[model samples]
Target: MGILTSPIPIQAIKTLCTNCGVRDLCLSIGLSNEDVERLASIVTQRVKIRKGAPLYHAGEPLRSLYAIRYGFFKTTITSEDGREQITGFQMAGEILGIDAISENRHACNALALEDSEVCPIHFPQLERLSHELPSLQSNFNKLLSREIVRDHEMLLLMGNLNADERFAAFLLNLSHRMLSRGYSPHAFVLRMSREDIGSYLGLRLETICRAIARLREMNIVRISGRAVEILNLDALRGLVAGCNRHRQS
Candidate 1:
């Protein structure tokens, strides 16, 4: 059984929103100390999910929004033909379950790509608290707006970019996000499989491999298995410049 499939003991939880390492990247971004305390009160506990275990499945009733305290996850939607379409990947400090807020049920499945811990913030209590904390409300709105912008960008990537350009844009985007979170942008390990990357980029597995090989040949990035070291960030950025300009225009 998965770590989170059964009841999690209270002792298993080691953090809360107030003392969380990634609070600045999460909902605690604009809140005061006192306000953070109020937010922390609603986050009763953290849950550990084993790698490959799901935090929640599509159509499950959404009860809480999970803030990733550590590790990574991928949210996906399955098609009628039984194919999984990767929607997005979530890393430490990111929030999940926002998709459920609109329908009161999850629209996609959130699976931990690695062993992960997440703080569960009760949604009803969060709504009540947000009303009392204007800064919290504003932050929540910004999170929603960020999601919308991300979705828009994905659409642009899928529609306008070719296979190699899509891969380049994907790397640049991940690099930017990782840098913002204080990680080395030029080198990082990919937790997800190449197949997963192919699904997210809307390309076939062979296509993804070809794209990677092409990038490697050009010395834009050096990929040794899952470890990726960006060798020419500017070249990678240049590959996607046309698509980016199109989006801007």
Candidate 2:
């Protein structure tokens, strides 16, 4: 577990969404100035979690949905045999705990991959406010729909794509998401471990290593430990598309 770093003061954390450059990609999008101001009232003071700390555990009662102010997280589920499966990785500006909205309890554990800060939006208050604000309600619906689409895409990747193609699609998806958050599309650190990534991609760690090595050999990406620099995004996309064509055939 990584040590917790110094966190911003509560007062400073309160302005997170309002001052966030990526607010356009978050739930705050399409909100009026007044509504954005109102939003600040419902959000709890930013809470910091150390790497390896569970932000919320499976079966915990859902109190609020969390918005990542900064850093990264991995959500996982443990099976009856005690095997853990990585469900997803979340980055800054993304929402967590949406799955709990359906059953009123968290379905999986959300763990911090690095020192992180999150804004907890009181779910009941958010629901009440959304009733009066049609735009807010619409945005909330969109968020849920987006999650469904993402899940469907993941299923497609896992079921249809070969190992190399699965790895390529994974990198491309991460690049797109990071680019949307104003990060460089061609380079970034992989916050989660190779084992966690393997779990998420439904591959063994050895297979992941082989795929990465192959990509590097092809000069499609330059990887040093966890740092990745995509050298040929077009070639990577072609690999993904080619896999889809093979699947269709």
Across 6-45, the per-residue lDDT of candidate 1 in tens digits comes to 3344333323555667889999997777788778777666
lDDT of 1 at 94: 88
Output the TM-score of candidate 2. Answer: 0.92
lDDT of each: 0.87, 0.86
Superposing every Cα of model 2 onto the true structure, what RMSD results?
3.2
How high is each candidate's TM-score?
A: 0.92, 0.92
- Candidate 1: give its CA RMSD in angstroms: 3.8
lDDT of 1 at 200: 98
Instruction: Supply every candidate's count of residue pairs whose N, Cα or C atoms clash at under 3 angstroms.
Output: 0, 0
Kindly list the per-residue Cα lDDT of model 2 for residues 118-218, writing each as its tens digit.
88888999999899889888888999999999999999999978888989999999999989988899999999889998999999999899888888878
Q: Which stretches of candidate 1 lie over 4 Å from their true place?
A: 5-16, 243-249
